[model samples]
Target: MFQASKVAIVGLAFGAFLAPAFAAPAQEAVDRTFERIAAGVSRAGLEPVVDIDHARLAAEAGVEMPPSRVQLFSDAAVNSALLAQDLSTGLDLPFRALTYAGADAVQVSYTSADFLKRRYGLDDTEALAAFDAALAPALDGLDGVEPVPVPTEGLADGYGILTLQSAHDVPETVARLRAIVNAQSDTVWFGEVDFTAEAAALGVDLPPAVLLLFGGPAPGGVAMAKFPSIGVDAFCQKLFVHAAPEGGSVVLFNSIVALAELHYGTSAPPHAMLDERLTATFAKALE
Candidate 1:
């Protein structure tokens, strides 16, 4: 398990913008996404890392930058060593924006187990199991959302997950997450979900949102200083069950690099936007 974690980190760099593919999102749309993601994050209660230049954030979101501002963006991208230092300190996942390119809205993420536990004081593994207890009622309130079979794949370190997504409101999904997270206040607010082009392209028009769901349940209470390869069951609980607004089915993989490559063709893990990690090329897929 530990060795697997090592391998994931070892291949950190991905080649720069190989495809020049595009997803054009309006600036207002990008702002709304930032607000939604930030609010969801705030509710989760994880501490923020240092802020990068918001202006650069705008640039990543596809804004035109002045010549002076170009340096700002480049400097922000290159000077992202703070996060690498954080990761080296044993923090498994960091919650923050990676790059908010127009239609290509992306952020740094972790499993529900790690992200939620660290945000709130819910560290005990039982805290995760508590969601199972809450699932029945919370899900009942979810209109248009349907539950389907969960897919499980046997992996050396953890089991892979497959499940049909529910069609639910973005805020409602956040509410459901709050029910599971259980650390949120009585009233919680989520930002407007910005749907990704990929989700839309698939006929799944889920609200654009980031839900760091557990495929199953996390082991709980492990120190961030230790990079423990989460067990198979643990990974299952961390699997994201993204509810497509209409018919969009988004599969949340354990590795974001896979999602980035699969969804946007970016060879590098979105983490590259966070630090000086090595960039990786896509492994050729064989049918």
Candidate 2:
């Protein structure tokens, strides 16, 4: 096992983003380390959903970046509990771990449970504990890697998330969003997750929720080209459609502007045109 004793849990005065990193063996490459982590997740009995190669995606757009990949795994039981507590958590669902080549060593990172609780206002302490405990084995035997803190510089405080009220119900809202994405020449359809059905398969009841995963590779490559770390979490765009208590559905997604600031520490992230396109797309979906 790696140096577990060196692992430190620290916080900041502002809303701290809990990103814990683990270092690979000295001789291990990023891809090898990635495989190791994936094998560990399987050993822990978690289902591997998808593995995104951000570096390759950037190369497809004629941009060069370090070897970086983000693999998403699923523990239906834990995810069901989180969604049962708050459907909004679906925005960050199906747990993701980022494996990237750092300046000196290869590292694997993921958003910590503490950050999830603060981000979604989750009050279920037991659920949060269960989440941490479940993923612990996948990260075992790796030494801790910490990031240098940077100032937010008065960026938007909304955590890069945008929520809109949809005039249609959940399924229709998803359909509309899907239509809009399909119509856009620049965007590509990735996949979709029906959270309600997923939970039902596990015999856990959850509210109506569906997560849409899609992205415009051109824009994504542009962002990753400039800020390689964005590939860690923001490569694939997500639109979460869930039933709203007030009748219509609610659509939620991440804004690249906010993501650039929060994740990459870009003081003046260049995301105007991309944000405009996204705004118009979602506006049409909601309408």
Candidate 3:
């Protein structure tokens, strides 16, 4: 492991220094990755672009020892997620990222930051720290925004998915999400929010929101029989539906990677640096 003494010094040297470089390139990478994956899936066939069916994916991957479907999905991708060989495409960027190799030859899975630090090796990884520094700007600033109501974004019959990487802090991420929901409700049920406990055997805390998905128009009526999160590990990924009567939109507060921090989702920068590979992942998710 490499010591990121330099990043620490940089953080200390510029407590208030602002630079244009402080941006969240991870988000862009995610966007692109998802888009391309979506395309790949489409080219492959007609269905979800990437990663779907939380319970089934886990069961096939062997993560069904405990908890329920909700918990299964939440923990599946967020903190203690499991994935099949097929849906495991890796993400690249300045997200607090932790990943696992899925059964799928081409797919790579993700986890949260706290989970990564407490269980995985991202905390002291020099390359990982550099990744975070590169993606810090896009993840910072959760101190002063007033919680506003979410405006609803109408759902079009032609629906497309926008998966996030999450910021870092959970509470702040939730708060920011609450603000977004309040501002927009027509599109509620903001994606999925997976939570995990420990995956020491495999390494790392469990990917946060790797499967936590949010969608629009009344829970999307998706039957998630095993979805369970409360008190399991203080790990939860419940869907907060935000909508008036006619319209609303669902948008994650930040990259799910950022939200993986749990209570500290927006506190620090990201763990994984935004690279072309990660950027490619983001693009694939949308395809």
Candidate 4:
């Protein structure tokens, strides 16, 4: 099993620091590299779930930000194994890679394997290995370069996931959530994923589950400006609604407090109000 080095863990405790660079013109490199990654995911037999254009989102919301994009792809086997261990793991499912223009070179970032294990208590080595291997193709020819480290500690159990009981079944709950989100002003509805359907495609059985993604770039941009890599935190907020074995639907999302601690190394990171705004939007949707 892979363990997070002491250095990596400590880096998360402190603030951001320099990491090895991927030399290229910032804007062009980010878009081109992300495109290559998206193509690689398709070539690897994974379903390309969604490609989020963060820079464009920021621009539309009247917030200036550098070029940034994220590609979310699905690996059925890996998804099944991880979610089997903990349904909340769905929050990070359909694995994503974020590429953004940084100070000197374009930087690529993703959820850390070690952080995933700790946050969800994941121990499926086979699945974890498979997940790690999927990103290898994107690293070709980038010798001695490392992705930006984004290790975070959640404020509570299950990464401080906020769960709500839904009065309806999976489909209805999803529809209601969608309607609520669409009603919000300045919020961009990114996309949604039917995990149950995706797993079924691979001949696996799972209870009804769906993930809804959306963002309010005006607030999201402010949060990201303070902590660039925090986009994974909630800029593209993930709302996971899954059927509970006990017979009702449940909705899940990360708490801003937990994400703040995770990404900014503090529960009270700068621009917290923006995080609050983003969280409230989801809270209203789930309600």
Which one wins on lDDT?
A: 2
Off by over 4 Å in 1: 1-25, 43-45, 51-91, 96-110, 114-124, 127-287
lDDT of 3 by residue, 1-287 (tens): 11111211121232232222222232233233333433433453322211222222223333331111111111222222322111221121112211111122112222233232332223335433433333333222323212111111331211112233433344344455544533434332323322222233346443322223232221211111121111111112222212112323122222222322332222222212212223343333322
Ranking by lDDT: 2, 4, 1, 3
lDDT of each: 0.26, 0.68, 0.26, 0.67
Give the higher-TM-score candidate: 1 or 3: 1
TM-scores, all models, native as reference: 0.25, 0.81, 0.21, 0.81
Worst 10 residues of 4 by lDDT: 1-10
For model 1, how does the per-residue alpha-carbon lDDT over 99-217 read when each residue is reduced to its tens digit? 22322333222233333333333434553444233222222222322322112121122222223343454345434553543342211111111223223444543334443322111
Q: Write candidate 4's Cα lDDT for 19-53 as tens digits.
A: 22323255557767776776777667777666666
- Between prediction 1 and prediction 3, the one with superior lDDT is 1
Q: Model 3: residues >4 Å from true position, as ranges?
A: 1-170, 198-204, 207-212, 218-287
When superposed on Cα atoms, how far off is each prediction in RMSD?
21.5, 9.8, 22.7, 8.9
lDDT score of residue 136 within candidate 1: 28
- Clashing residue pairs, candidate 2? none
